[model samples]
Target: MMAMVTMVAFALEGYVNFVGMTLIERSANDKESAAASWCDYERKGTRDKVKDLRRMTGAEIDWNKRPYATIKELNELRNMFAHPKPQKPKVREWEAVGTDAEFRKQLRDYRPEYEERLTWEFCTRAYDDVEAIWQHLLEVAKINPFDALSGGSQGFELLAWVDENGRETRA
Candidate 1:
């Protein structure tokens, strides 16, 4: 569950950065890479991306405002689950057992109280918070997320108006 939330959060961060790059390129009329190559080279993280987004879009994306606020707590929990230090031996054990409880001993390591804390309701709430932030971003970017013709259970043709020599015309 922690892994799922972490993955979603990271993906959202990447998407936000990509949108920032797109806005910057479009506004400047520079047909360069849509994503920030400089930031990537420098290994800039999500906070840097958020700053870039704010600068490029001129929108105050107060992550502490609404749905995004939960992200900080979510990240903290994710880190705790991922890299539980020796100082918190119980947390480490919980993480290890939850990750893979193949053995009876591993299963026994997890207490009933821990199970109560890490319930289905808790997991879903965390996921919903991440999803809410994603939805908010989509709205801010004015991106229409759905295209019936593009994505579904059934696959569609890859071609986009093929010409005489099998050349593709997008517009």
Candidate 2:
């Protein structure tokens, strides 16, 4: 579950960067300037990058809405696991009654929220949110998601060659 959540977060970041870079490359007049702009854009944090991509593509995303909120929460979980810090143990109190006596107990340990987020439900939801965001961005950018994923719209061709006779052949 943790691995899935982490991968989904990474996938979202990668998708945003890929789309932003493609847009920049297409719109810029100079390749060098486009490369430099991409470098500056890539330095931004994940949330900021998402916002920048949304603005660039003219897509509206409500941060407080379903898929967006879920993705944000997933990113938070990923960040927590990625950059962990020592957390003070939480104190939990419990009461017990035996046949002979009643006892009170205190336990100190990590909070349940961390474990709670590692559930299958959360992981599945994170995956769904990533798909939703990916589709939304692709739609707004007017790029077919299937083509993008299959490398069909990447603006370059492979298996093409020019013979010594200067005749070009394409696969």
Question: Which candidate's lDDT is highest?
Answer: 2
Question: All candidates' TM-scores?
Answer: 0.52, 0.75
Evaluated at residue 129, the lDDT of candidate 2 is 84
- Model 1 compared with the native: what TM-score? 0.52
Among these predicted structures, which one has the highest TM-score?
A: 2
Task: In model 1, state the lDDT of residue 42.
Answer: 34
lDDT for model 1: 0.58
The segments of candidate 2 whose C-alpha lies over 4 angstroms from its true place after superposition are 94-112, 150-171
Count of backbone collisions in candidate 1: 0
Clashing pairs in 1: none
User: Clash pairs of candidate 2?
Assistant: none
